[model samples]
Target chain A: MNLQVSRFQFFSIVLNFIIYSSILMAPGITVINAKQDGWLSMLLALGVGLAANFLYLMLFKKHGYPSLFELMDRSAGKWIGTALNIVIVFYALHLTAMVVRNLSNFMITDVSPYSSPYIYQILILLVVAYTSYHGVKNLFLISELFTPFISLFVIGSLIVIIKHFKIIELKPFFYNPPSAILEGAYSTLGFPFIEIMLAGAFLTYVKRKDKLVSIALSAIAIGGAVLVITVILVIGNDSAYIVARESYPTYSVMRDVSLTTTFKRVEIIIGIAWIIGLFFKISTCFCVAMMGIKHLSKSKTFRGYIVPCAILVWAMSNGLHKTFIDFTNFVSMDWTLYWFTLYSFVIITMLIGLARKRA
Target chain B: MQDWKTTMKANKTTREKIVLAIVWGFSLYYIIGYLAGIDPFPITVWLKAIYGPIYHTLFGG
Candidate 1:
């Protein structure tokens, strides 16, 4: 289709990716590790994430707007490039599966237990596949249309939960052990930040290379700051013990809001926000993955692969089973380390190789 | 390797069209399943089987 997306659309997609996945559960997980100083840990993680973002920017600048696949082929050999492509494709597929499973679990447990996770996963994947199959343009347009509502929902959640924010709850914010802070930072950096590496694939399509670095940096900064504030507010509003034990602490904070006793249980609003943002996130990732597959296979019609890929993703997710705790532990422990190290190495190595070639 | 421009110009045949239609039909199974509340059994079982092994390998219970 020779579809080209605008910079604003790209920016909105990036914003959606950054905000959706981490906000809902980060408060709960970070507090479990960092206690009263969870927000500080998030800030530290933000600093690390920003540095990584700059590193990715440097790689992009050196390559002069090459897509991730092209850059890998240029800097590394064709075989190595193909190997890396396989790895990235699998990594992205796994991520999409994780997200689907997580969202399905949340919806099934909280919203409607009668609803089957299988149904939710398949339906959502179809929507994602359809949007992605139409190409990046459709995905970007959807993000643009949904961005405002997602933003308002997030901001509104913050406002509604603000009444419970107490200075006393934030006291002794630096009380956590250094190990706890380190663990929290490591997990966060591994997750939402390092996952930004996947964005490199889409950089080739960005029309404005001049502003790409700045916009990318801004996404990390703004997204990280929002997460930090959310963590702080969650910690301030809820007890550390409660926050740690809760599955969706921010949603719990939303539930606690009741302005006139009539506006009770407003957590559904937060669910709507997460769903919108998460939908865009998954759709964008699916778009990039499909694009990469097309580029690799030299396919004319990318839509041909959508059903197979979606089926693969649905299977990958459904295999994870009924235990959220097991999934949580895997994400927090194993996946975090693997992704953070792998992405950091890829970006750094690509930058060095590209720079040397340029020099 | 053929150039991307030329590659994209290649037209889809009737078989490809038929295949695409069938794929779309399978994809829509989910929509109908959700709305009708019918269980699509063997596919769901297959998914669970694939996911279970991978999750176990990744997390190691």
Candidate 2:
């Protein structure tokens, strides 16, 4: 069955994908490294992300919107492409596992300190596997339908927190040394930003190819703005020290917001937004990995793989880190570098394909 | 050289079998590790050991 997503849906998918896990953890990570300058680090990351997106766009244009698997096939030949797809599939699965683990870890540690991570893990996996089994159209549809609510929740949090914002807390901006700021920018650039390469998985499904670049840029810009706002508010309201110390600064800031004299603890809105966004994120990664697997194996049935995929993710995520600190240290010290290196090879191969085409 | 598209379309290729085997093997290791309460991320440990210094050198914690 052929699947197609309208440009609007494509835009929403990009927005949702980038915002997925970043809102909860990225601000804390950045604050620890860059302090008050974390927002500026995000700004730097945005510029780098846009350029990288432009490169992917050009590569897509040259290759005529092949899915990442098919693009590798065309550019690198059958055997090599299949091999590359194996690696890409592994990377995608690992990412999905991390997203799952991160969400479960956050819920267990921050929101419900009494609950077991396994419960959230099973709950999230079921939902992710369910959505992924339906195919790509449903994934985009869900994102299109849910992104507005996520946006509204984030906007509401910002509005409610505005009165609590202290300009003094945002002071000493750019106070971090150059290395610290660059390090923050480097990690941010590596993540939610460069991970936009995952968009290639759905590139073929986008109906209006002419508008692809614009849709991508707008999505990246909007997603970057969301991250910037998240960092600024976290720092502006709670200060960099609190943001650095806390595991989920964005959630903290949102939870701290009071709607009025009577209404407090408005974090449910943010929680809903996060859960919906994470659903889309994990589902997208799951779907894309399965798609790549299907393409590589030339299998006709994708549904058959969904449960196995979920089981694999569950095991890998469970085994990959024994504790939240292990998870954080791995993502901090290894994941960024590993993903950047992996995708950099992909971009290089694509660029080589482009060069060969020109030659 | 086998024509990949033809091989994949006609039947499960050898490469597919190899990939499946490898994936299943890795999955089994993880599953058994979980059951045995063993660490499943030696790769993570190894990479962190190797990359941690390089990362700190390049970016400085």
Predicted structure with the largest TM-score when compared to the true one: 2
Candidate 2 lDDT tens digits, A232-302? 88789998888888888888888877777788888777877888888888888888898988887777656
- Residue pairs clashing in model 2 are none
In order, candidate lDDTs are 0.76, 0.82
- Give the runs in model 1 whose Cα sits over 4 Å from its true position: B1-61
Q: Tell me how each candidate scores on DockQ against the true complex.
A: 0.08, 0.34
lDDT of 1 by residue, A1-359 (tens): 26666777778877888888899988877887888888888899889888887877777786787778777777777877777776676677768888998899888877788888888888899899878767778888888898988889899899888887987887876787787887777667767888877877777777767788888788778888899999989988997778999888888788778767677788888899998878877876777677766666655667877877797678657654337886776666656656765686677559667676878
User: For model 2, what TM-score does chain A reach?
Assistant: 0.97
Q: For chain B alone, what TM-score does every candidate structure achieve against the true structure? A: 0.43, 0.57
What value of lDDT does candidate 1 attain over all alpha carbons? 0.76
Error of 1 at A302 (Å): 1.3
Categorize the docking of model 2: acceptable
